[model samples]
Target: MAERYEYLPHHLLRRRVRDVASGAEGELMAVVNENVSDTVVEHWVELAYIRGSSGREFSTSVDNIEPAVAI
Candidate 1:
């Protein structure tokens, strides 16, 4: 079977992001999207400060987010 998204709602995860312009380096709260096609699953998170320009939210594959064991 294919991999599953283990992180649940309220779960936290650390995403490996770039260190360039507007790069994010910190823990992010996970918000799983239940409305997805059967073939795919995903979640939305806000790492970069949500504001003008960075107003758009980010969508990441469930596979990319790992459980935040500490902090």
Candidate 2:
């Protein structure tokens, strides 16, 4: 295993992530940009800024994405 991405800045760590809701295969992507502390969430949920391969950037809770293991 490489490393767990939780509890860290997205830009500072390897950004191979996948959209859990998309339900599509092969959507692994790298973080093109980030502002880990830029968003405010309910109940103090930490959000990460992510820019996917489609060039869509958004701030979302870490639960929305999962680390895409490299094979």
Candidate 3:
């Protein structure tokens, strides 16, 4: 199953929805195990991206670990 996602920073203005769009509301999402091989493996990660704050952007990525978690 494909999931929809959106992000709202703490600095952004907050709003309330009064209607249902047949979807979800959150910055994180988890799609069902579709179009993926059962034998294939996957990992949860926080990819590096531009973070805009104080009128500046920085480059960063997940630190290298000796052993990745299995669970």
lDDT of each: 0.39, 0.48, 0.24
Task: Provide TM-scores for the models.
Answer: 0.29, 0.41, 0.20
Best by lDDT: 2
Worst 10 residues of 2 by lDDT: 24-33
Pairs that clash in candidate 2 = none
Candidate 3 global TM-score: 0.20
Best-performing candidate as measured by TM-score: 2
lDDT of 1 by residue, 1-71 (tens): 33333335543444433223334333453545443335445533323211123544455544444432334
Instruction: State the lDDT of candidate 3 residue by residue for 1-71, as single tens digits.
Output: 33222232322112211112222222211112222324345333332223232433332221311121223
Ranking by lDDT: 2, 1, 3
**lDDT by residue for model 2 (1-71), tens:** 22223455454244566556763223323332333343353123455555666666655555667776667
Question: Model 1, residue 27: displacement in angstroms?
Answer: 6.2
* Predicted structure 1: clash tally: 0
